[model samples]
Each structure stands twice: as C-alpha cells, then as structure tokens.
Target: MKRRTFDKLVSFVGLGLAALLLIFAGLLNFGANFANDSVASQLENQNISFPAEDAMPSETKDQLAKWAGMKVVTGEMARDYSDLYIWEHMKGSAIAVMGKPATYSEVSGVYMGLVRGGSTDVEKIKQYGDLRQTLFMGNTLRGMLLEAYAFGTLGVIAGYAAIASLVGGVLFLLLGIAGLMHIRRTPEDATI
Candidate 1:
C-alpha cells in the first residue's frame, strides 16, 4: 500500500470518528439540559414547602387516619405494602405537610425502616398518631429529595460524559489534521 494513501485513509477515519464523537457529545449535552429542566419544572409545580417542625395539622392527621382506615391491602398488595403504602397513602399529604423536602439519606433511612421507633400497641394508635404524622412527613420529604438528587446526579453524569466526549473529539480531530498534514508532505508514490 502507498504511504500517502494509508495516511489519507487514517486521516479520514480519525476525522469521521471525531465527528461522530462530537455529535454524540452534543446529544448528551442536550439530553442533560432537557432532564435538568424537566426536573426543575416538576419540582416547581409540586410547590413543596417543608415545615420547620415534625408536626402535622390536626386536620391532616385526621385525614391520614381516615386514609389508613380505608386501606385494605390483600394478598400481593399486603406483601408489597412497604413499597406501595407510603407512596399511595401518604405522598400527597406528606409533601404538603412537610412544607419542604429533606435530604436523600434521611428519607432513605425512613424508607428502609431505619428511622422507625419501638412498636406500639393497637390501643395506643390514637395516642401515637402524632408520631405517625411526623414519620410520614419525614418519609415524604426523603422520597422527594431522593428523586431530585437522582435526577441531579444523572444530569451531572451526562454533563461529564459530554465534556469527555468533546475533549476526545477535539483530540481525534487534531490527530486527523496532523495525519493529513503528514500525508501532504509525503511523496504520492511512497510505499509503506
């Protein structure tokens, strides 16, 4: 094979790869921006205003009790209660009652049952409703915070990927240009 032709081929391939990388980087950046915007919009729409204290309004507590009373999990639902219960029964109230979000770690702890207190008797259910309210609020706050953090992390990763890809693309392009220059300086008939 001719040395000039080989260099030309390498140059073209490198340039092509660079172009592809740049395009990929652009797409990744676009996706990251879109995701960030979406998350921000969703958060704004939810209007979460976490409270300073772990207290729920009396009306909210009553509503929680009513919802709890209405819940009749059966079979698989009962088995999946942990997964479904908080999200289904408490998410809206918890978000509203919380008035603001908590950190992901705090919420995850609640979700994982790490934040739970000692078991209470059935007779003490009414008396401990306030405690339940506080727990619910914390759980809700944690869930939202965790979701936001996840979205933010995804955006950050995408941004990093985009930056890496852009750098790679630029390096590849420079190498391709250098190869083309080398080809130009070599004799056309030079054999490899």
Candidate 2:
C-alpha cells in the first residue's frame, strides 16, 4: 500500500527472479561440463579412426535396401540401425567402417533430421545412415568427443548467462537494500 513498501516488494521480487535465473544458469553450465567430462573420459579410454575405405558390405547394403522398401528410411529406422547394426558391429580399436570424416555440424544436421521426421531422398538416407552408423559405431570415441565439444559449447553459453544473471541479481539486491535504507516515514517522502 505504502510507496516505500511497494518499492521494497518490487525490488525483492526482481532480486528473487534474478537469483533464480542465476541458479538455473549455474545448473545448466554444470550439466554441460559434466556431459563434456563424461565424453572426454570415454574418448580417452579408446582410439578412434575412420576407415580409409568407405565400402558397405553387400549384405548390409541389401538389408538396408530391404528395409527401405522403395520408401525413404524413417528416423526410427535410422535410430534402429544405429542401435542395433552399428552398436553390434562396433568393436576393438579399429572400429572399421566407411565414409569420410564428418564434421560435428554435419552430424548435428543429420540428427536434426532424425528429430524432425526423415528424408525422402534415398541417397540422403544412405549417406546419413552411414554417417550415423560410423559416428555411433566405428568411431564411438570420436562421437563422444564431438558430443563433449557440443556440451562444452553449451556450457560456455550458460556461463555467460550465469554471469549476466549474477550481475542483475546483485544489482537488484543492492537496489532493494538501498530502497529500504532510504525509506522515510512521511507519506510525501515515502516513495523510493
């Protein structure tokens, strides 16, 4: 009701919201770092490489074609291959497979396709399928490394947000304290 009280309330609310944002940012950053560390540890435990020869076994290619059934491969199918075919075949230090080195951004784009729906182009599906297979299977360690990089990037963004939120929180808290300190009893002088 009083101007001083209203100012105090507003300031406190602002400070509280700022504090929450700061906390959220911290959690996000921590999560990102944790993800990165986990990936790093996994990568460090193994060696990864892309096969010089990018050849798909005829049987495997046939199976993929059968699965395709004249229609484009669905995201679900891609994931299935990643989980089943790729995961099963993945072994030893070699982790042999086909295809060139794919950038993280390219892999991310393919992943986005999986999240969205699927592609109709047979070649795109095959390329992405191979990409996912190699990334998830043969080069699992490298894949983890890529994932860690992504998480680290996210952490950097979160860190920036955390710093901003912390600054805002401190400012709001200081303003609230100042408002309370400067409050006057007289109605005319009560407004902060």
Candidate 3:
C-alpha cells in the first residue's frame, strides 16, 4: 500500500478509538450522576442525622464533631453513623447483657441453651432473649446503612472514573487530530 494510504488507515483507527473513548466518557458521566442523585435522594428520605456535639462524649466527639447535628447524606456520613454510632450502641447493649461486648450469635446461643436445659430462671432467659432481639434490630439497621455507604461509595468512584475518562477522551482526541494533521503534511512518496 502507498505511504499516504497507510497513514490514512492508522489515522482513521486512532480517530475511531478517540470516538469510542469520548462516548464512554459520556456514558460514565451519566452513570455517575444517576448514582449520586439516587443515593442522595434515598438517604434524604430516611432522615437520619448525626448526634449533636454536646450529646457526643469526649472520646467520640472529635471524630464525629464535624458532622454533628447534620442529617446523613453522603457515604462518609453513613459510614460514620453505621460504624461509630450503631456499632457502639450494639456493643454497649451486648455488654449490658453478657458483661462484655458480644455477638448476636453468642446471646442467641445462651438463650437457646436456657430453653434446652429447661431452666426455671425466667428472668435470665428473658434477658438473653431481649438482648438478642435488640441486637437483631441493630444489626439490620447497621447492615442497611453500610449498604447505603457502599452504594454511595460506588457513586463516588464512578464520578472519579468519569472524570478520568473525560480527560483520556480529550487527550486521545487531540492525539488523533494531530495524527490526521501529520498525515496531511506527510508526502505521498514518503515510505516508512
């Protein structure tokens, strides 16, 4: 093939790649926006909020102080509430029952043992049962909040990816255009 024709082929291929990248950038941007909007709207509807700074203890105050008294909206806020608030509350509830931080499974095990042994200590058995119930509810809510955090994190990652894609698309588009311009300047008789 002629050198000019070869240059044209390579140039067109580069242009094609640039076009694809640009399209991908657009799609990624759309996806990022949708995910962010959906996450924000869902969290807003839930109306969860951080505790007031005054209500927070000294130990947790510094970490949570920034968002104190604010409604949970972002992934970071969801994570703070789920891990710091819900997890701490669950641990405290467990400690009250078992004298230490314990898992729901452990409390349920004790409750089941009490039933199986036909123990007459109704109060002790009831304590375990109540703790298990409370733990179950806390775990459920914590799981949901963590899921929201994960979804929101995905949105955040997608937003970054979209920006990267846009930059890459622009770079490749310039490169492709430069390649076409180079082909114009390239002589017909040039062989490489």
Candidate 4:
C-alpha cells in the first residue's frame, strides 16, 4: 500500500478511537456527578447532624468527633451518622435492657419466644416491644446509610474511570495528529 494512504487510514482510525473515548469519559463523568449530587441532596433533606464533639459516645468518641457539629451531606457522613451515632445508641440501649449488646434478630427472637410461651407480664411485654421498635428503626436507618455509601463509592469509581478515559482520549488524539503529520512528510511515491 502507498505509505501516505496507509498513514491517512491509521490517523482516521486513531481519531475515531479518540472520539469514542472522549464520549465515554463524558458519560461517566455525568453519571458520577449525578450520583454524588443525589446522595448529598438526600442526606441533606434528612437534616441529620453529627454529635457535639464533647458529647461523642464513649466507644466511638474519637472517630465520631471528627464530624462533630457537621450536618450529614455526603455518603461518608451518612455512614458515620448511622454506624457511629445511631448504631452505638441502639447497642447501648440494648445492653442496658437485655444486659448485652444484641442484634435486632436476637431481640426479635427473644420477644417472639416469650410471646409463644404465653407470657402475659405487661411490663416485660412492653419493655421488649419498645426495645424492638428502637432497634428496628436503627437498623432501617443503617441500611439506608449503607446504601448511600455504596452509591457514593460507585460514583467515586466512575470518576476515576472518567479520568482514565479522558487521558486515553488525549493520548489517542495526539497519536492521530502525529500520524497526520507523518503522512504530510511522506513522499507521495513511497510504498509500504
């Protein structure tokens, strides 16, 4: 094939590749931005705020204090609120009542066992009921926060991908331009 023609073909192919990569980068960037914004907005609407530094819970005092007085606005913040704040409080309450830090399933099973045994002590029934309710709410909140964390993580991954794609696009574009310049410098009668 003629050297010029071969170079032209390769240049066009490189340009096409650059265009495709750039388009992919743009789409990924949009997705990442959307995910980040959605997570922040949803958390903001909840109006959840971190503990005052001095009021940090005993077990998570140092970790929780990092975000003290800050409202939940990001997935990381949501995770901190759920795991450090809400989870600790729930566990503490359970320990106070049940004499142990137990999971929601554990509490539910015990409560159901008592009911099945036909226990009719009103105070005990109500105590279990209240504790179960609090745990249920805490678990639900934790699930939501974890979901936000997952989405935000995906967004972060997408952002990194977008950056890589952009770099690839730029590299391909430069290669394409260099190929075009090579074609210009090639002799018309050159064959390869």
Overall local distance difference test of candidate 1 = 0.60
- Give the clash total for candidate 3: 0
How well is each residue in 36-155 modelled by candidate 1, as lDDT tens digits?
Answer: 776666655655432222233333443334234333222222222223443434444435434443433444454435226544454343323543556667566556655665676687
List the lowest-lDDT window of 10 residues for candidate 4.
121-130
TM-score of each: 0.58, 0.44, 0.92, 0.93
lDDT of model 3, residue 42: 83
Q: CA lDDT of 54 in candidate 3?
A: 81
| Candidate no. 1 TM-score | 0.58
The collision pairs in model 3 are none
How many steric overlaps are in each model, in order? Answer: 6, 0, 0, 0
Predicted structure 2: clash tally: 0
Q: Model 1, 60: alpha-carbon shift in Å?
A: 27
lDDT of each prediction vs. the true structure? 0.60, 0.52, 0.84, 0.91
Enumerate residue pairs that collide in model 4: none
lDDT at residue 6 of model 3 (Cα atoms): 82
Q: Write model 3 residue lDDT over 126-170, tens digit each, in one string.
A: 999999999898888888888888988888888888888778778
Q: What 10-residue stretch in candidate 3 is worst by lDDT? A: 54-63
Candidate achieving higher lDDT, 2 or 3: 3
Model 2 C-alpha lDDT per residue in residues 44-97, reported as the tens digit of each score: 454322222223233355444444322212223333344334443542111332
